[model samples]
Target: MILEVAILDVKPDLTEDFESTFKAASKIIASISGYISHDLHRCLETKNRYILLVRWQKLEDHTIGFRQSPEYQEWRSLLHHFYDSFPTVEHYESIILP
Candidate 1:
């Protein structure tokens, strides 16, 4: 599995609106292929910052399947404007520890 992470820093005074909009945008992402699950976390120290973690079956499932789909446009429209600057997204794989 692959994990997609994004650190979103919302614009000042737009956090509430951003969160509400994200509720709708979440449905768009969850409908895509290979979308296992996701979580949204708000930062304690930085109220306008959020962390989004998504689990996918493969990197292409997010980088290609989602990013290239029409649903991505919807996701962008609903949430993109809220960001202070474009968020940087990265993918990672889990490492087992004993």
Candidate 2:
């Protein structure tokens, strides 16, 4: 499995609206191939900082599978503008667990 984490720093006033839009956006991604699960996390120190944590069977499942789908445009439209800066997305593989 691959884990994709997107760290976003949104404009403060846009937080609530962004969250509302994400709810709708998540549904679109959920329908895509290899989507396992996802959750959104907001920073306690600042509400404008968010991390989108998602799991997929493979990195391509997100990079190619979802992004190539028509639904990607909708997801982009819903959540893209809220970011104060371009989100930093990184992929990781689990190697250890207690």
Over 4 Å off, model 2? none
| Residue 71 lDDT (model 1) | 94
Highest-lDDT candidate = 1
Error of 1 at 20 (Å): 0.6
lDDT of 2 by residue, 2-66 (tens): 99999999999999999998998989999999999999999999879999999999999999999
Model 2 residue 17 distance off true place after TM-score fit, in angstroms: 0.6
| Tens digits of lDDT, candidate 1, 35-72 | 99999999999999999999999999999999999999
Report lDDT (Cα) of residue 15, candidate 1. Answer: 97
Error of 2 at 75 (Å): 0.3
Candidate 1: 10-residue stretch with minimal lDDT = 89-98
Q: How much does candidate 1 score in TM-score?
A: 0.97
List per-prediction Cα lDDT, in the order shown.
0.95, 0.94
